[model samples]
Target: MFRRHGLRATAAACCATALLATPALAGSDGPGAPGAGDDYFPGYGNGGYDVSHYDIQLRYQPTDDHLRGTTTIVAKPTQNLTAFNLDFALPTKSVRVNGAPAQFSQDGTELTVTPSEALPEGSLATFVVEYEGVPSTVEVDGIKPWIRTSDGALAVGEPEIAAWWFPSNDHPRDKATFDISVAVPDGTEVLSNGVNTKNASLAGWTTWQWRTTKPTATYLAFIGVGQYEISTKTGAFGQPLVTAYSENLGELAGPAKASVERTPEVVEFLTGLLGEYPFEAQGGLVSSEGMNFALENQTRPTYSHRFFRNGANTSVVVHENAHQWFGDSVSVDTWRNIWLNEGFASYAEWFWSEAQGTGTAQELFDHYYASHPADDPFWQTLPGEPGAEEVFSKAVYDRGAMTVHALRNVVGDEALLDIIRTWVSEKRYSTGTIEEFIALAEQRSGKQLDELFNTWLFTKGRPPVGEATGVPVSATRVAVAPPKAVAEIDRTHALLHDH
Candidate 1:
């Protein structure tokens, strides 16, 4: 999502060094974690509440190009209410709550449901919604999905396309369990979050049911349906898993297969470094699309054909996988705080780079410093922007990566890792803010970090540092003036004589 702006050149130099020298700070309450009650602006709109759990059973027939499903939502009222509202993504055909027909409204983009009864606070209520639609091709910033020629693979990106085939919140702020049952054409494969508990063929189609025990952000919930070959593996806790890819790209699947095969190693490495894996099941899916990047959709990650070709060289896989901890487990409360997700993901790239011994961690910082544009406007951006577009810019990614680098430098690797592990373990299935992160960092680092955060976050531009130092340098200078005209000289002489 980094914009290639020419203006970034000026700041790039400073960002590189500043990132390395920046100190670790306490985790602060900068922004709330996803699914946490909306505290930013009260009474503006309903936050991601009222729905505590989602049990969705769906059927997808690829041949008919149609999807149908029943979604049972268990919700609790966060506030005292006479009426209940829930937001659903995509086009829905029929919806009912507690077996009674429920009235619904839609604006094409979002479907809102109004329950008939006033559910008291802390009381649980259930609603069922059914819908079907021809899955819309995934698009982001006008980019269309295409099968990758490198492997004839297909993958989805740019948010909840699973909801394109179902009815649910498309935002990551709402994390809930989903029991997805997909029925695809007999030959095609179906994959989703969590462990695959059942797979059966019925009515000329294959029905795959995946029960996710772990709570997941809506965006991370997913399903990849197509002709795919499966590969199996195991990770920590002896969790059984599999990686899927198109049959045509069997040869090129090596790297992707290797990457998937390394899932246990990656999980162990991260768990030993950050914390335990936060989800019940984890795997990777390789698709034919040349989307801009890969998506870390909770348990099952979707990757572009490019990822499989270069294998581990594409850090997008690592970045997305890291979200299982940052974006999926803890979650970002709003798009404005997308840095909490993107920044951490970008930082994971460097963490992996450091682990691979490709270069010293400092080298990673140098890369960010050299690549970041000087004129990047993220420094001047307000946190309450409508979408996460600005926050996901390079400033948040690279600069944020540098922030983590600086923190590691200040706290030392062991302490930093400890803090990270603790944060994930403690905040699992919950939400947190930048301030909260800062507090955790300070508590773990045993040092105050306000000055550090100020230098990197609050300033209008990169902090003046040694590499891009703004120090004034003295230089020999000359002053020149226009020569006086003869008429002016004569006038001055005449006036002096009169005096």
Candidate 2:
């Protein structure tokens, strides 16, 4: 899974138009290609149909951590479809197409279905599935998927982790809207992606229905289920905001609240620095799940207890929330272009640091560059196409941000921010690739950046000495003095030391 999580929503007929299928005509009879032709993870993402929306309804039994689910998908065929596949992991009870029982079989993660009637290209189809099993954490290519918590679950579906919890074309390339409804025991609660449309109790169970009003990638779709203390308020942009945590967190709850409450101000800050916030609502979630990672999940970001342990790491918050623009809005078209998500978010930490006078981007870049030895393997890694095993490697994070720093050095701070703002505005609710970013940088900076990219993103060795990427010493004085962050850092240290 590509990390630093963020992405999603909405039911639009136009959503079926992800990478329009031109191979087969409307009347041409054929099977849609499985796996949307991705260079990495060839087995993920089914071919043949473009899904418009997903209606997922599941009931979780806390006692056994068992989940029974019925999922309905609305999609359009790219080729005249005889059979299609959904990447599902749970044991299947039944499957139906257009209300008629469909022949279905599960082979590993893919749930293949043969409809009674062939679906013509451009025609809409509905496939529904019923399944029940204890949802388990999946280990895919050494990546963690849906993690079962002490009292709940966190769905972190980077790369192909989505299939662990729900069945669908589990790839970022195939984006769709979602309506997630989860039912829990009487005392339990659920917080998922998008706006809560319904919260009702029946027969000693409560069902929470959420609707996402934006096209969401399966990896970005999420469901946090268990006993949660839910809070709602207006966000920075006045969007509907929601945050959740459990009493099980104990003392960490106080710091979690304080850290999450900073979201409004963070959004406002990033909004001015980047562009407008992408989602209609904004929030965050804290869980006992020990993912040791925080995900920028659509409108709501999810954090691990470790973050709250140190008063919710503002740097991590800056990293994830920045994903709203870089990863969530201007998503990567393929897993190969993950640097577009992580690199920008990583650079955002530098941006926060610079603004608060903690450290400049160049200072951070210098720290990493100087700390690592020449042949330390870190220098040999590339952020772009960092093979499967090293997808989330430091090369994708620190080096990626260093690449941004190098670019910022070339284009200057103002042009860099302008280029980012432009990229966010242009690619909102859509996807882009590394090449597109390069082109955008050149266009915005009016300078050739090919060399910088080659040295930072493509090279397998340390870049040349002092290859340009530091602001003038005089400019450092312009940054705001760290009065508040200093206090906050002290408070966090006290919290951690107290425990």
Candidate 3:
């Protein structure tokens, strides 16, 4: 029973600004709330406990797309708890609480557990859930979770994909460090977030151990297991830039390698614009898996094989990589504020295009303003308040980009970069709400932006720009260095040697 988009929340009528500042009040003595009380996905994250780390060990069988795993979740309850819930979707064989077989029952996606002893406030606890089944992606409102590749699997758990593969808190706000080990047969390699500390072989199988010490939202945690041509390159700060592509991608592998090879160049560009690259290592994956979209999965972003097309531009590349700063590192407090991710990344594309000397952000902003009629759904929809399905709609991507451009027009480029740096520096590795972001903007720009935010983010219909702040500083058409076309890669020989 999947809905097309997120069902409208029936909870308290809360706006993005209101939903973001929700404090985690200590839980009562009874059972915790089945849901985390997130205004967007009520069935998502759980209450009472806060997760600190996840040690996920998955043994995958490619023949039948089956996965067997034991997930170890380390958490601390905020209040005394007799029972708590975890979001798990795979068929579980057994469950244990801190090595004890706790009484448990499953209802839908929620796995409710009553521990042998009641967990008191500030008490540490662990849950080990043994699950095995053909983990299918959660499909709702057109957004699908994991992608089942031809040979193995690719797990990109944005929104609710993690629950489909592992039992844990399945919301963006509940971030945790991860030690992910995906064991696979020889010929298939496992790629995940952060640094690859272990890749040891035993008999016919290899275990790939990836550790991300940085706290990561569940949505950004990813795993890709497939036959790949892995490449390592030196990036900024001399971190290894690791990329992988499915061998079966055929000609698609060429553009994929090309796009991925530019990872260093993109990181360098983004680092100059936005403080620094947020993760330890930067890399990418190009796969035959048929998820048409690209995800900003923490350190390594994943792209579909389709984007390797000759016509496909690196704007998507710029977009997803920009998410490393906007989405991955500085997270949204609620799904309602997803525009903070999409909008910033989308605006980064405009910045890239402007830097490339072809189109100015001003020109792109004007074109959308003129081309789309006033009543176009793109302009009519609000990013601060999106329905389940409308999360990534034009309001999120295009108009979101437009919102950033409008900000740039308000504060000059230098000041805008200052505001951005302040945001990422202060909110890095943490969740924030729209109100906080608005306050930061106002403080940095010394401009009361209630009208501006209300016009662009909150209200619907075409946003009006008062004639005062509409004028943009002179943007000369200067060719940005590292002269690779948006769609074309400078390196061609990289593809010839891909094995």
Candidate 4:
């Protein structure tokens, strides 16, 4: 998941090369690859260049759901390229490569840009793209990732939201910093990833600027434009803590606040287990829209109001904030390695349950292991290699957590904690794989773990009721499933609506 870190040229230095003339498609010069070559969604990220930053400016109108924007991308070409592709779906008005007008065409979601001059290998290139459209109408495979709210829109989803709102190297493999500025009606609030740096208003419009201090995956970068009750504070460590609740939340607002307000505490708890928090900020967002799933959108995770309909549900909050360590900071190498994200986050919920005295981690693990039968199909799908279609399946979340607990049993609590701390410390802001994680665990624990990981993650069938499953033969098992608050976290992924 880690690419070689190359020396990057400044945007100014790259734009200066705009004087070069366009070259014929001969010799070693050609077009960039259309995709980053992921086994799951091959057309996700673009090749031939690595993106370092995205400066996006947009004005959104809620009434018509119209969005207009100018996005600037700073990248370094991995190859000499005549043309390159950006995963985008909106109607592109214009494109400039290195400040020179470039010929561009849109074929579905792929925006192919032919620079006025070839972008030489190892040279930085700056691309500016202007586009406008109703994001809700831009559909691919009958799916629209944009969520239309009563007040504005929500740019949130996993693996596929960036293309609908902005042009990007839309893959976790290509992590980049972001500066997102959105102009909406003066009274409408705008929230995005990272810290909200500034807000200014004039002529009945307010533009909010947010900047990320750390590299973020394309899907992890999000924007919400709507009426929100925003809150801000400083954490014990002095990091900014900001949260937003949609004004339209109505009855769910109180519970949402009750749960989300504890983000700083959850961050503190997770930091104790996973080492220092990785980002410069911490927070959560609760949306009133119809989005059914909660997304770990970088520093601020976004949730569906439904997560708190029953009452204050911090279990869901614990699940997402834990992702700040597992998913956001240490991303998966490819979609196939999604267990690295969901599994670890799900395990955090059980960890929180144990800390809260609601249930023991062993009891929770035993309940799940005993509940699902050998032929339950839940055991048939391997979490380590859940194919593209079932990447978000039950096996990835529940079975994935079980796998973590199994490893904890084999390595003991102290060694397992050391392994987790070392894993995140080493892979922070980068991508990792199951194999890498297994090797790290073995190295830290000083024990052979290949068979343990294989049985828990690869081989499907439920492990025979024994010590290998992380449950002692004489341990007290949960009489029934844990309370709904904890159980609901596992069911949230299954109820995810189409993005």
Candidate 5:
């Protein structure tokens, strides 16, 4: 049976707001009010656009059976446009812009709105979307959204699943800041991006206000509401960070805390290695009910309860933590360049492994190289390749890790570290493409890498190995070894050389 990633199946609800639902007064400041700013607009086609600033407020309430909310987004248009389009990734019940009813079009996955009034370049525009629905189950392939049994856990993966809860761009390229307020059933907890600015109690419901100061990719935006035991800590930079796990999983808290307690250390390590921690307001981790792998949501990294099963290994913690630097701090401009996110995260796994004495960094490279398909067609496939379905594929993850490893080999460890540090320092709070990364690597390494990348990235099959060339051997005396074993041995030898 075909399986869909959870994000793709349940994301339909995220785009469900109607474009021209109601007209509101331009100056009216209601529950969902737009903030003062130049009408910020995101470019749709060509190179994706950036949302430099946004002031938005959302009023939401969730009953036992249904979730409802209205969002007002004030955006400054970065580019000139006569018509403004905002993406509601789900089916919308209603939409209005600047107190005027707007025309909307839908393609199931996107709700595009065109305001009745022409928006001038650099003008401020306000968009409002009101929606209500039964919280959809996240489904991908056959995998369904599930929560881990551990305490205070909630994660939204399957990229862009947040749209199921709110109208959004649902694409990674479009980045923005958000002010999210959510009301959950009385006694339940709610978690989201940014710092918790306010909390208030209403009739049988609790309201939470979360404001993210950093620019964020739409996919990294998140919300989780349920009963959870809250924990807090301070990073080396003194940034306040929090973690919430289910009360029932209280027993796992110690291990979970121990596993992640080094978050500050990891952050510091990455800051020294990469540049600086990208999101400064706060960082968080929420254990979620799910059998799938962890989802590196910005600020808050959602993890499966199982991850805490074995004392929250250093490798896993570092992997997710690394994302705060690579994925969250320096986001990929498009899904095709997802390697820029996942690959770096994967590489961090090796970096942590090497640091913790689990293995040398070269060992990690050999492991990935050994696992790579000899006849992989990933290089020939673009980010939006016809058959490609998910961004977490081997091409984006493992192969991408190998690319970084190869770069390290090409530039040596110290220089590779310098390149990464510069990349993060230069691109923090911004988005980058693969070509830009390649250029950055070249500049830092002081060496041409086009041929190197072509051999590993563009080739249809694995490039010829140095010693793999045909050499006559005594067939009768030749020793035969299992392919897997031989591969492992070869990798280990390569690792020794690399180290």
Candidate 6:
């Protein structure tokens, strides 16, 4: 996530006016544990089950900001299960497990469902949950991740947006395929991840249908319901490219279009380095709403209009799409390993800059290395193991990129790119860890890199200015600032990095 400074919560508390549908239910049993064992977010995903796919159907009325939905989940329990938990905040009317009425209750965002009978280990079970609520009213720790726009709603965020809009396992560890269909007024355009398989219109409402065959993290699945100027085109590699611009964007529309329309070019550029483009489609959505951050939501990314405030900026474009390979494809096993996402994506910005004749990756690395002094607090946060509060800190982003640059200097360009390609291919649709990445890097480069990684990623001070650390303060160091886009990112790093 890339955030601008001074962004405030924009959702208003609206009452849900949709009528609730009665659900079948029997006697209640017990609720399952509410976490999937990630220490950073203990209550995120429930344990004991693996989700295979989700079929979500939603109806939204922009006038009242009310949302109604039914979500069907296909999953299997790892062990015999009487009940399981789904991370959701909407008020549920009813729930069914395998066509039988199931007792359900919600404690905060944890929706505990007790099926009529225990599911046998390895048996596939189906869960159907019907819910209706005003998504803007849902809050977690005083933060509301859902963005309610004037024309419609934007269901986007990191680590937590799915709970407010739909029931989910709610973690990167439990990735699943998605078929999301959103029904809205005729004039509204609904944009989501993956392909637009179909669109059906009835009366004055239209249901925008979309599906993703690839396994995607719940946080990466999103929907934008609003009035948008939609465009479709074939990409450089023959993949479908879809881009949307909010009709309300005034002066920012041109710059946003100019930058995002280059998605094909950017994807082709990244493909040369990261092996192949992982997804089937490529696109971007530029919201006119005053959002401070841009999110990489699976196949299509959502950008804040503020990213183009100065002018056309493709660096942020590179950052979010680079996430397709780093954060989206090969996800972090745990949130603590976030540098694997942010660092590599940030390094992609440097790579793009060099390709555009703006700045070399080394020049960008050296600029950041010299910018922060030894006593700077920026060096205090360890990028490899940033705690919950510091997960999106500047250290995780810039220092993380510095770490990648340092690795490139030590491993050589060919070895570093090969290591990245191998890592992407090996961990294609699953999660990865820092340890695994370290081992792979060392193995591929034929180097003992523990000290180098530890000094840059784990230690709590500015690394020495030397070749070993990749910040050689020799005559090669030129006194030049990075491009405006990078300088803008540096300026925004001091702001909130909300998911």
In every candidate, how many clashes are there?
30, 11, 4, 0, 48, 0
Q: Is candidate 1 or candidate 5 better by lDDT?
A: 1
lDDT of each: 0.58, 0.75, 0.76, 0.83, 0.57, 0.84
lDDT for each residue of candidate 6 in 108-212, tens digit (9 for 90 to 100): 887889898988767889999999999998776576788898898888887778998999999898899999999998988999999999999999999999999
Q: Residue 149, candidate 1: how far off, in angstroms? A: 13
What are the TM-scores, per candidate, against the unseen true structure? 0.77, 0.88, 0.88, 0.92, 0.77, 0.92
Deviation (Å) of 430 in candidate 6: 0.3
Residues 1-499 of candidate 3 have per-residue lDDT tens digits of: 0011223443453354235324345856867667766666767788888899999999998877889999999999888888888887777888787789998888667888999988887988899999988865444334446568778888874676787778888777789999999989987888999899989889898999999988899878889888888887787689978898888888787767766788788888888888977788888888786565678899898877766666445776787788888988998888788888888887787777778875677776766566566677767778878765577665677677778888788777887898888999899999888889889988998887777778888888877646333423322223343224322321111221231
Best by lDDT: 6
Off by over 4 Å in 1: 1-49, 137-163, 310-314, 371-387, 466-499
**Model 2 agreement with the true structure over 259-328: per-residue lDDT tens digits:** 7878888888899889888887888888875466667788888877667675656766777789988888
Descending-lDDT candidate ranking? 6, 4, 3, 2, 1, 5
Name the lDDT value of residue 17 in candidate 4: 27
TM-score (C-alpha) between model 3 and the true structure: 0.88
C-alpha positional error of residue 485 in candidate 3 after TM-score superposition, expressed in Å = 9.5
Best TM-score among the predictions, by candidate number: 6
Error of 6 at 169 (Å): 0.5
- Model 5 reaches what TM-score against the true structure? 0.77
Q: Give candidate 4 misplaced runs (Cα > 4 Å).
A: 1-28, 466-471, 474-499
lDDT of 5: 0.57
Q: Which stretches of candidate 2 lie over 4 Å from their true place?
A: 1-27, 137-144, 466-499
Error of 3 at 282 (Å): 0.7
Q: Is candidate 3 or candidate 4 better by lDDT?
A: 4
Question: What does candidate 5's lDDT look like per residue over 1-499, in tens digits?
Answer: 0011432323332222211212223433221111111011112221112354344444433333355678776665444433434544335677787798877775533456666765544567677887665444433344333232322224365443554556654445557788878766577777888788898987876788888888887667777666677766676688878777655556677776676666777777766677767786445453534333566677777654555654554455666778887878787665556667767877776676666666566555554454555555654443222122454554555556666777777678898898888888898877787789889888888988876666555545554442121111221122333223223222312221231
